[model samples]
Target: MSSNPESSSRVDPSIVPLMRSLALELVIYGPIVTIYFFLVLHRTNNWLTNIFNASSTEYAIVAVLLIGGQGVMLEMFTSWLLRRIGLRH
Candidate 1:
């Protein structure tokens, strides 16, 4: 058999909803997380320490990594949920 729809790993490329979610998450959490890490935990920055906030050349690269990993987790979760509902091969 060719196979059922849910047997594949292919994700639709449109991804508009996921892109929107990614942007909103970056806007909401990126600065806050970076600031906390740099100023609070690392204690290497001051209020005016925009330098440690995040280099422009690397705009929240770590944050993007975390968010991207979270996206993969979410996809796995959805796949598991769908399988539980008999929607998968």
Candidate 2:
């Protein structure tokens, strides 16, 4: 309700770095994740299908492990990349 227009247009200074970090992460992660999935699917499709056909429970367990491993590896790789690029410490 104030007369000052500047206050309405202002962004929090503290949020700028966070926004930049998120943008950078998205930009970097998008293609890397896409390529990762492409390669993994390409290489593992037949093996995974065979496992699934042999045992549903084994397939479920392997799927969970693969997902968990992907998450961990992606995080590690992203962090390392960011550090190497001097964007993150």
Candidate 3:
């Protein structure tokens, strides 16, 4: 019922960035999943025992460090992938 057609047909600019982030997340999580299977799942008792042996503070610190390391690795991987794909110089 409105004469302004462009207003009704306006596109969202944030969707592209959101999608790119999702794709990057998928790529980033691949290594974490692989590591989980190879290290944690394969040696469930050993890993669980190690966790149980550590103090709460020590466990929290290690968990944070591992997550931070994963993020750093993800960034490196994303950069490498982008360069290989010729998207980044």
**Best candidate, lDDT-wise?**
2
Q: Among all windows of ten consecutive residues in candidate 2, which has the lowest summed lDDT?
A: 80-89
Clash number by candidate, in order: 0, 0, 0
The per-model lDDT (C-alpha) reads: 0.58, 0.82, 0.69
Clashing pairs in 2: none
- What's the TM-score of each model vs. the native? 0.33, 0.67, 0.46
Residue-wise C-alpha lDDT for candidate 2, range 23-86, written one tens digit per residue: 8878987998889778877889999999999999999999999999878987888888777666
* Best-matching candidate per TM-score: 2
**Per-residue lDDT for 41-71 in model 3, tens only?**
5776676568768777777887788679878
Model 3 poorest 10 in a row by lDDT: 80-89
85 Cα displacement, candidate 2 (Å): 2.7
lDDT of 1 by residue, 1-89 (tens): 57877757776666675566555555655675677567655773342256436475454665576579767976675556445544333
**Which model is ahead, 1 or 2, in terms of lDDT?**
2
RMSD for each model, in Å, please? 11.3, 6.9, 7.7
Better of 1 and 3 by lDDT: 3
Misplaced by over 4 Å in model 1 are 1-14, 44-89
lDDT of 1 at 54: 49
| Model 2 TM-score, all chains together | 0.67
